[model samples]
Target: MADIVGSMRVFVRVVETGSFTAVAKENDVTAAQISRAVTALEEQLHAALLHRTTRHLSLTEAGSRFYERAKAILADLDAATDEARNASVSPAGKLRLHCAPGLAQSTVAAALVGYQRDYPDVTVELKIEQSMPNLVEDGYDVSLISATQLPDSIYVAQALGSAWSVMVASPDYVKRNGMPLTYDDLATHTLLKLETPVSPPDEWHLQSTDDAHVLPLTHAPLQVNAPDVMRAMLLNGAGIGTLATYSAVEDLAAGTLVRVLPQYRVRPFTVFAVYPSRRYLEAKVRTLLDHLRATLTPALEAVGERVEAMTNTIGEAAGQAAKSA
Candidate 1:
């Protein structure tokens, strides 16, 4: 079979110009190749498309009707192709996003605002929840998830960055119940456990530079399933709880919450940008993911710095208090 679209384009031009040689010259091919393309198209359609002569070329009745339809089809094809191509250069569409709990606030949310600002034509719809959404079923363009490991799925997971969960207690809680210094010490203190999709209810892994120690959480006096509730309880002097950097950034900076363990952090959770397909990733989704990686990664890094700074300060104070005693 012939390349029908190509032949149709050449045939339309040949009818308008009334010469195969003119269309061939425009296409940078010999007239013979152009003539052959028309012949193949005519043979495939079982109709005479052109009435050719020594000096003149004219379209048959079938060719005249086909010419009009072919022109419209070719115009539609070109317009659709241009629209698809322009998406990469200037993204303009609606992006639906599903974000995991505690991942949509602070830096992530701000980054989303920045993305919309930069791409004014794009409308974003965001849903934040604990349950992992079915990207295809739920009609989500992308999912921002933070987990130690993601479940196996047909989606493509792109690494955004990693964030450490730190043990935090309110100033009143620390003053009243005292702070836990080690894994053994933490076993004795009140444990306000946060149960999320990313965390196990039984244990919390305390990760240090050298190694990680699993702190068995056999006793949880208060167990909550949400980060906001855990933060609220910690603020009420309930107990020490784990908080991701994004969740604790403001509190840690404001001195409302203090780090419980300066030397050990809860095992880091990795953030991933999940989508249905990588090869057919659209511009809106691609740009938003890139914006997230650029914005969220830096924000997490800055929070990490602040975390270290607070840890150093807390460690120094503990050192002085021990020495004075």
Candidate 2:
């Protein structure tokens, strides 16, 4: 039993640090001791775990699967230890999270500030990325993302909120070039294009309280790939661009930019908080999810309110302009 526990710990450490020598140094043990312990573990289980070479050690396919399960078990073991030490205490451990770039910057980042403040014992790490990572394989505790498709696998997901992709232009562009009063008017202005694999090509679908329309913005003179950079260009008065509502919250509130049709906005994109299922939940992951759910609710509300308000203001101004003309 002691050998099993010791080998498991060494295996987990090696996976995390990617080096047997590092694990040995940290535990004050010899590399041979580590190897023998792992071999004993494999022999007991009757399964080969590692494919080792002269210079490197990598997990076999079975070993890769085992490592995930083993890490979760070790975490639960630690939690059990803590509970035994202090029965009344709440969870405390390290949590790793994955998120998209826009959501990470505008929403998750803010929530984490309060989460850290509320739970000093819980350590949180964020992996901000554009690519959707394999949560179980990568060992992420939770992932906050916006996507329509999800893997129908052994994972559970919770819907957090929704976001919309909308058209926005700088105030300077509106003044110098001209505001687009209708769908047809958009053709006359420079449509600063955002190129992303997720969105439909040269097509934007927007809806108002009463009507819906599709505009093909393929006639754009300029196109950029990065959402952040495109938003930056729009804010700096370079041209009109479209992006998710969360990314443009601060600028919209300050009136540096404006929405085109006050009555119309795009259909909302869905957001989710996803994680792997475990028999026993760890304290760090539970606390982190709780904080995320609590803190991000207000952020979604604030961004939605701003969009609605901007829509109204633009509608009113357009109406008055027609009357004066």
Best by lDDT: 1
Residue 317 lDDT (model 2): 82
Highest TM-score among the candidates is held by which one?
1
TM match of model 2 to true structure: 0.68
Clashing residue pairs in candidate 2, if any?
262-311
* Residue 49's lDDT in candidate 2: 91
- All candidates' TM-scores? 0.81, 0.68
Task: Please write out the lDDT profile of model 1 over residues 151-244, one tens digit for every residue.
Answer: 8889899988888888999999888887776667887788878887667867888888877898888888999877888899988889889999
lDDT of each: 0.86, 0.78
Alpha-carbon shift of residue 25 in model 2 (angstroms): 42
Model 2 stretches with alpha carbons more than 4 Å out = 1-89, 149-151, 195-198, 317-325
RMSD of 1: 3.4
Evaluate residue 301 in candidate 1 and report its C-alpha lDDT on the 0 to 100 scale: 83
Model 1 ranges off by over 4 Å: 30-32, 48-61, 131-141, 150-158, 172-178, 209-212, 219-224, 275-290, 321-325
Tens-digit lDDT track of model 2 for 1-325: 5568778888878877777788889989898887788888888878999888888889988889989999999899999897755422465566789988788888888898888888787788889877668888998989887765566878878777777877788998888988777777877777777755346648777777788887788687677767888888887788777878898767777878777655567556777888887546666666777776777866787788877777777678878999999
